[model samples]
Target: MQLSFETDVEAFRAEFAAFLDEHLPRGAESLERPRSTAHIPEWARRWQRLLFDEGWLLPGNPPEFGGRDASLLQQYVHLEELARRRIYHSFNPQGLGIIAASLLSFGTEEQKHRWAVPVLRAEKTAALGMSEPGAGSDLASLRTRAVLEGDRFRVNGQKVWTSGAHDADFILTFVRTDPDAPKHKGISVLIIPTDTPGVTRRPFGSLIGPADLDFNEVFFENAEVPAENLVGELNQGWTVANGSLGHERTLLWLGFAERLEDLTQDFRPDGVLGRDRYATLVMDLQALRLMGSAALARAARGEQDVAALSVLKLFGSEAVQSATEAALETAGPDALAHPARTAPFNPMTLEDFYAGWFERYARSFSGTIAGGASEIQRTIIAERVLGLPRG
Candidate 1:
């Protein structure tokens, strides 16, 4: 079957492909994924800067913001092509995808110039400050507080699971500014420079593998932040938080789809049972792609379907988990052997591919939790789409 679009959209896809051929690093598709989102090597930084300078960083935004005001369909095509090539536009996902997008949506001109521009240009990095120890999926239950003083706000609280915080220039933090108000209403967002006094960061490794220090716990003990750093109106942080999460969950399915596709080709399992499992996986992946396409079409038509996104998030993440597990089972003990750790990592080698199976399987678990856990997504789907009463 042939799927087609406007002449310009196809042209845009061709242009992006040619650009990748000319500028994308050779063997980038097989290069070992970075251990941490904040670990932007010199080459990766240069790549990000090149995308920004060439207006491919955020094609939906204006040119000054490293975009050309491309149409929704064009943006969709752009993302698809990038996903097909497994190319990353930036090392800091939250910084480029969530924080900067939020600032563009809600920040003042001065704030945009100060924070948003630097993040988009890859001149500075940012981390999202949400998901406290007590408030992972339930953001409204956060205990962090930021009180308004004469000219600055005194922030005294802690945020855990703050990705890339240790390397971030600033943190777009959510704090409770009005304790007397409702849980969601009392929240407010603050842009706190990581170097500010009383601010501390502690990096920690995750289950993905050793040397993967990707998440951090950030503390703000009487940290003084200027009042002007507020992104939107006071005590309106829930709105900003939702906006950030929306940006985050929007295109997450693309990566999962790409990974699952790669898995189907890389793992050749024997036996009828294993073959059947892989066949099921391939069908699931096709379904996910169709769902994503439908969601993109709805978005292009100016429709916002929150429930559809929740469905995609739920299905795509779990599908990846299953596919990775299948790949490990197919490779058996060979997949468990650790490949020799080497510099300038390339995964295309047979040894590297087998070694990565276990790590990929372990890392797939994070997808089920990040950007709202699978349980949270199921709740959203049941309550919103299925119209089922809360249990």
Candidate 2:
């Protein structure tokens, strides 16, 4: 697929760029720490509200839901430009991007009317409750249970590694509504209010060391939510979950592109060692970008399967790992030792910074493990994508 932007897309990009130029955070340079996850602050919420007022927050949603009824290309343009400018950090992505999108796909009319507008407006934040303490990538093994009783479902289980649970007003949770049935078949999705009587959220510090990007362990003790809270049909949550994964991977290419640009800025073409290393890194980065962009385009066109997303995830994660390694190598021993003067692009200090890079290294490996393991991705590619015989 051609990667070039069309005339209308170019206009969309220009408009988004102008918005970012006018509204990006002031005094943001003084902030010493880097946020791991995209957690929008109050100022950022005001910025998002501005976008909502202008019908730009949920660019992909229908116009009735406070969106522009934007085409896929238009949405891609918005995301690409935002990521290019590092403006994604200023939006409540979980609400406006992921959950809201999923809701639009599977939610009932009442569900959409109740949640979509607030979500797009940034009035309510949502957290994903898919991963549990015992179940991460192997979501089929999830033990979170929900039992039907009268007009409500009683939910009782714990979800770990839940980002923004403490700050979120609601959770889009996956639970087993039928323990006796097959693992994947018994699952169901629910939108539970975080302020429910039996709910408790505890913040768990990330290995990444970002204070606001706290992961959480959420406890649901016989939490009762209306039966109408269910998203899509019962025992079909896996389908919805898979759909969510596809949507996420579709947009991740923009992030990978942004990282690639950041990786390139550190290169010094005239320097002897710099020229050689930079050349190799840039080539690999371009290849990864090509693969990721292809996967995204295929997904957007609905030509790719859910398993194909795992391939993009694998390639994207590895590219990020390789790029970080190259950046560190370029810095040499001084990279180990923080430079006396910090570059605007490379703002991290070397001392008190071991934890961040270490976390990146660990999480690069974990990213493979998070969405799905590299092994799993390879299996899917081999058997599903490549038509290899199962062993």
Candidate 3:
């Protein structure tokens, strides 16, 4: 299949590049590595605001909801350009991208009008409340309970690995409404404002890099939200959650390709490695990119086999690990010893951030585990895509 963009997309790319050139933060190189989940720097916020104003931030949303009604391919181009510029929109990624999309798809019209605009405009950030201490990949087994009260649902549970919970205005959460129902059938999605009476957020330091990227654990005790906050049909949240995961996997795969390219270029022999090793790394990097692109194209075309995404996740995670390992080899003993240096078009302080990179390596292993483990992906491919019998 031809992966090349048509002329209109080429023009979109040019326009996006110009926007990045004009608005990328001045003196961003000298800025300290980001350290908190606070709003992005004013310069970066201005850029996001520009996109919001220009109706580009949520290009997939319809014009009535402040988007251009752009094609999925066009949306892909926008993301590629943004990632190429290494522009991290720290404001409300979860809100604008994942949660907003979920809400738009499954939320009531009132919920959509109430939540989507603020989310897309970065007026509010959102956290995902899915994983619990014991439940993650086996999401249907989650134990968070939302008991129905007269006019509200009283929620009580702890959600772990919730990114930006401490800073977010709300959480688009998954909770079990009927414990006796089959594993996947009793769950429900809810919108819980962070400032509710029984809600508490505690910050945790990063397992990966700076504290800014810290994921959190949130506790909700008798947190009462209006029954109207329920998203989609009650007792059917598993479907919505799965849909969100599918969207997330697609975005992650695309972002990973961009990051892999950035890392490969930064670690080139003249830049950071020896010639021979760099050549090998380049070839591996190209393969990873092609595999990811192919998977993304399939997804853009509306393929529902989660295994395709899982394959990209598995390959992308491994590719990142391999690239980092190669970089460590290229750095030799000095890898841990060199002062941290910031790369122009990558997450800041990547070189001397050995601790961070190592943390990422550990986390990449979890990428397969988090959304669905690699083994699970293989199972999905076997049963769903390949039509193999389940054991």
Q: Compare the candidates by TM-score and give the number of the best one.
A: 1
Q: lDDT of each prediction vs. the true structure?
A: 0.84, 0.72, 0.73
Q: How well does candidate 1 score on lDDT at residue 74?
A: 89
What lDDT tens digits, residue by residue, belong to model 3 across residues 258-334? 75776766666777657876787777667766876776677677775566677677776666677767666666666
lDDT of 2 by residue, 1-391 (tens): 5878689878987887887788665565424443433355565566567777776776766667666877777888887776565554334556666788789899998888798667776667788899998988788889999998989999999999887788788999999998998887899999999999999998867655455455889999989999999999999999999887666666664565566565566455654227777786677678767876676576567685666566677776777677666655555554443332353432222223322333335455555565567788889888888889999
Candidate 1 structure quality by residue, lDDT tens digits, 139-221: 99999999999999999999999998888899999999999998989899999999999999999987764567878999999
CA shift of 153, model 2, Å: 1.5
List the candidates' TM-scores in order: 0.93, 0.85, 0.87
State each candidate's clash count. 0, 0, 0
Local error of candidate 1 at residue 2 (angstroms):
8.2
Q: By TM-score, highest first, what's the ranking?
A: 1, 3, 2
Give lDDT: candidate 1, residue 177: 96
Off by over 4 Å in 2: 1-3, 28-39, 210-213, 269-276, 296-302, 305-308, 329-366
In angstroms, the error of model 3 at 256 is: 1.5
Give the candidate number with the greatest lDDT: 1
